[model samples]
Every structure is written in structure tokens, then in C-alpha cells.
Target: MKRFDEIDEHNYSSDLIDEMFKLITPEAQAKTHYRMGLAAKIDDALKAKGWKNQDLAKALNIKSSSLVSKWLSGTHNFTVDTLVLIQMALGIQLLDVGEEDKPNATSPDNGNTPNAPVELAKNIDAIKQSLTSVANSNQKSFATINYK
Candidate 1:
């Protein structure tokens, strides 16, 4: 008995419904996909190499196996230090710590390509130099203002 608007009608269609579901779903995101893939690869590698969770824990210098388990779960937001340790232990380069893989990298949600590496590096260096200059200027200003 009620007349639906165009937006409401579009929302009820199966295709639109599926799209909406994907947009709202965590697993549908690219970052989640990348992380899950990485986790599976790590899991397979560990099994293939006969390395146990305890072994990884010991190698990372973590006392508890639970922490290692958490790392392998793909849900834990690992620190850079932990990621480096894992890379060394597994001998697998999951992330490109260097300049590679920059151009093709995308925003996690929309998959937009990242900015050029050279430009990004230049901007970062400029910011660093500016901050250092500002700090030096501040120190000089304080010294000049000191009466004693």
C-alpha cells in the first residue's frame, strides 16, 4: 500500500542488497583480504617448515605461546618490531619495508592508488627539515631572550 521512493526501491533489489552487504561487511574489504592471505601463507609456511607456535614465541623472545597465536590470527595489529621479527624468523617478506610496493598500494576501502614515491619521500624530508629548523629557531629565540 505504501509507495517506495527510488532510493528505497534501489535498496531492495537483490544486486543492490548484495552490494550493500559487501560494503557493510568486514571481510569484503581489501585490507582484510590482504591480511587474511598473508596469514594463510604464514600458516602454510609454518606447517611446511615444521615450526610450532612455541618455536615462533621463543624466536620472538615472547614468553607465552598465546602471544604467538594472537600474531598468527590475522586479527592482532602487530607492531613494526614484531613484523620485522616475523620476517626474519619466517624468511618471508610479507611487507615491503623499503620503497618497493608503493605505487600499486591502495587505500584500504576504495582501492585508490597511492601517491608517487619520490614525491612522498620529498615531502617527508621537507617536513623533517622544517621541524628541525623550527626547533633550532626556537632554541635560539629562548637563548636570546634569556637575560642571565
Candidate 2:
């Protein structure tokens, strides 16, 4: 149970640090997943308590329905303070990001696995190409439309 701060930085290998960075840098995405799981738990609790979104919003002191809507939609990038508020409001812990639940928990695919990094890179490149194609198409569509 070594804390991140307790890690021996002087002895740290670049490869090890890079792997750690890959795991830690995706925290926003991990938090999004955790929030979604928490939301599902809260929805279940609300159903049991016969409470609605407005009720939870009122408890949280959030005025707008849109605020709650954004939270439920998982599109909002919540700050640490806001996450604490939501935890208090919902009475459930939402900090677990399912890192242990990864399919390749023993060895990550980012050059840590035998052939997984190659496959991962190929998949990522394909996704990037698809996204770029979609973006280019959208840009062309926008350019052709004259908004005078």
C-alpha cells in the first residue's frame, strides 16, 4: 500500500513512469465512469425512497433542472469539490474508478503486454482516421453553406 508520493522518484524508471502516466492520465474518463455508476446507484436509491430528481436537486441546493440533467447525462466535467457535494447529496461513495476491473489488469497493453500494444495502436489509428474523416466531411458541409 505505497502512496504515489511515497514512490522513490530517484529510482523510477522512465518506462515504469510512462505506464503509470498512461493509467493516471485517463482519470477524467475513469471519473466519468465512476459518476455514471454512482448515478445509477442514486437512481435506485431514489426509486426506493420515492424521491425524484427535483428532490435530490433541492437536497443538493442545486437550483436548475439543467444542472441535474447535465450530471445525469455524464457530460459534465465535475470538479473535486462538486464530486464531494454529490457524494454528500446522494449518500453514496462514487470514488471507485474500477481500475481493478480492467480485463488486462495483470498487464496493460501499452507495450507492457506481448503483442497488445501493436493491436491497441492499430485500433487507435483506425479510430483517429475515422474521426478525421467525419470532421473533414462536416467542415466541407459547413463551408458549402453560405450564412449571409
Candidate 3:
């Protein structure tokens, strides 16, 4: 007979356990989501500035750009210090609580602001175009970026 330590605890297949382990806990998952969102914002900012990963790494004072890549990968856990450093380097906000969670903020006019989403979408589209233009122009731009 196999000892308890030698047997699978929950009778789950090894592959299944491996897959489950690949995913983080719910809290960490939430954090990953937040990090990914920040990464996307940073990506946009980088494009807007026409800066490369090496430029960002230099701004972060990291000798290697791999560190920046890891920070952007979303799977890496970010420390408060790292986040602050990124914010300082990029001059951007990474974790501001927006109007959605504001205690006094409302949708205005009995939640009848139906155009707000459209406006936001339009603004996002504009920003995308701006970034693309910067990228296409091959301009050596630099701006604030944050990893936190």
C-alpha cells in the first residue's frame, strides 16, 4: 500500500494539478488583471512616446530591458516599490481609482448619460491613432510610463 504522502491528495491527475497550479489564486488573479491593464496603458504610452523597451528600461534604471519585459508580461507580481519606480520613471499614473469607484461620482442625469461610453470609445480610438502615428513616424519620443 502507498503511503499518504506518496499518493495524490485529491485523486486529480498530475496534468490537472499542473494546470491548476499555473493559475494564481483569486486575489492574485485580480492583481494580475490590474497589472495587465496597467501594462496595456503603459504600452499605449510607450507607443505615444515612440519609445522602445530599452528606453523604458533605461528610464527605470534597469541595465537590462528584460526586467521591463517581465514587468509588462502581467504574470509577474509587482511590488509597491517597483510600481513607484515605474511611475517615477514614466511620469504616469498606474493605479488611480477612477470615477467608477468614486464615493460622490455619479453617472449624471439619472444615469441617462448614454453617450459617455461612446465618447470614451471615441477618445480611446483617437489615442490609438495618435500612438500609431507616432510609431509609424519613427520618432524617437519619450514619455512617462508606469508598471504599477
In candidate 2, what are the lDDT values of residues 106-139, reduced to their tens digit? 2334235432444556778999999999999999
lDDT of 2: 0.67
RMSD of each: 12.9, 18.5, 23.2
**TM-score, every prediction:** 0.49, 0.41, 0.48
Over the stretch 91-132, how does candidate 1's per-residue lDDT look in tens digits? 876666675645433333332433333445677899999999
- lDDT scores in order: 0.68, 0.67, 0.67
**Which whole-number lDDT from 0 to 100 does residue 94 have in model 2?**
53
Listed per model in order, the count of residue pairs whose N, CA or C atoms clash below 3 Å is 0, 0, 2
Model 1: lowest-lDDT 10 consecutive positions: 104-113
Model 3 is weakest, by summed lDDT over 10 consecutive residues, at 103-112
Which number leads on TM-score? 1
Per-residue alpha-carbon lDDT of candidate 3 for residues 48-102, written as tens digits (9 for 90 to 100): 7888889999887789998878777867677878877777777776654565434
